[model samples]
Target: MFKNSPYTIYGITALILIILLIILFSYLGLNLYIISYLISINLVTFLYYGFDKLIAGFESVRIPELVLHSLALAGGSPAGLLAQKLFRHKTIKTSFQMTYWAIVILQIILILWLSF
Candidate 1:
């Protein structure tokens, strides 16, 4: 049933590309602090998504999608995807998915462009 799943491919590809880029750049002036920053930002993004999912059924205010998208754009898309997969959140909204995938693709493009 998972065959032909674009999500699977996208996730796998993104992970591979990220790792490769990190390794590549680490020798070309990338510092541990930058990696730490990515890790920290990703952790925050992951927590935010989880928090939003937890409060989804409440009558209280919700975490805005814009914030989520912004987090993803700021080097947290991987964590965002992980949160979506783990918590089963934001997977059903086609518009949100579109925006998310677009952000991911943009990140990939930016990385490739900056690599050269």
Candidate 2:
């Protein structure tokens, strides 16, 4: 099914895994803190997509640009990038697109920085 589009396959599988993880956590009555963290991450991911779309409309404003970076910094970079690519919503010839990817790269560096 995914022979033509590996990205779609990976995205769908990742989404199913997230849902299953949530269900398992809920079923097991896992720690509230962990659940909260998961929820926050999802919220950020959702907002990142929305903000990316907004950038598509306005094509201005550095604040939204920074929020994009911060969302990535907050650990939603991979999902945000996937959404942008899959939706083809923000891929264009503009600083917004350039900055968004730059932020993604920065987020990865920050994550690695904190991890190591």
Candidate 3:
């Protein structure tokens, strides 16, 4: 299913890293609320990608880019990246990718800042 895209490898690697982080945090007795929020948002973001892909096939009204970015900023980026690669949705648009990566970078900064 990965086909010829290197992005598919990167996406899966990111997902694995996220899952490992989650497990480590849980083992360290970190905040359950945060963990739950991450899981929820990721699931929602993944589903949104799938939904958007399905609609796109039919030329239906699409989900707003802002909403997708918002979800990524809210801790769903791993899922977003995975979905983008796996579903091949929203991966070809330069504008969307730029915004999405911006969100991811911002989130990483915020996360590092918060950890300190």
Tens digits of per-residue lDDT, candidate 2, 1-116, equal 74645345434444565566566667677757566446655555665466556665674432244445555565566666776676675567488677777876786787699999
- The lDDT for every candidate, in the order shown, is 0.80, 0.59, 0.78
Which stretches of candidate 1 lie above 4 Å from their native place?
1-31
TM-score of every prediction relative to native: 0.72, 0.48, 0.70
Better of 2 and 3 by lDDT: 3
TM-score: which candidate is best?
1
The candidate scoring highest on lDDT is 1
- Minimal lDDT window, size 10, model 1: 6-15
Tens-place lDDT per residue, model 1, 1-116, is 74545444434444555566566667667669688558756877788789889989998566678778877998899999999999999999999999999999999999999999
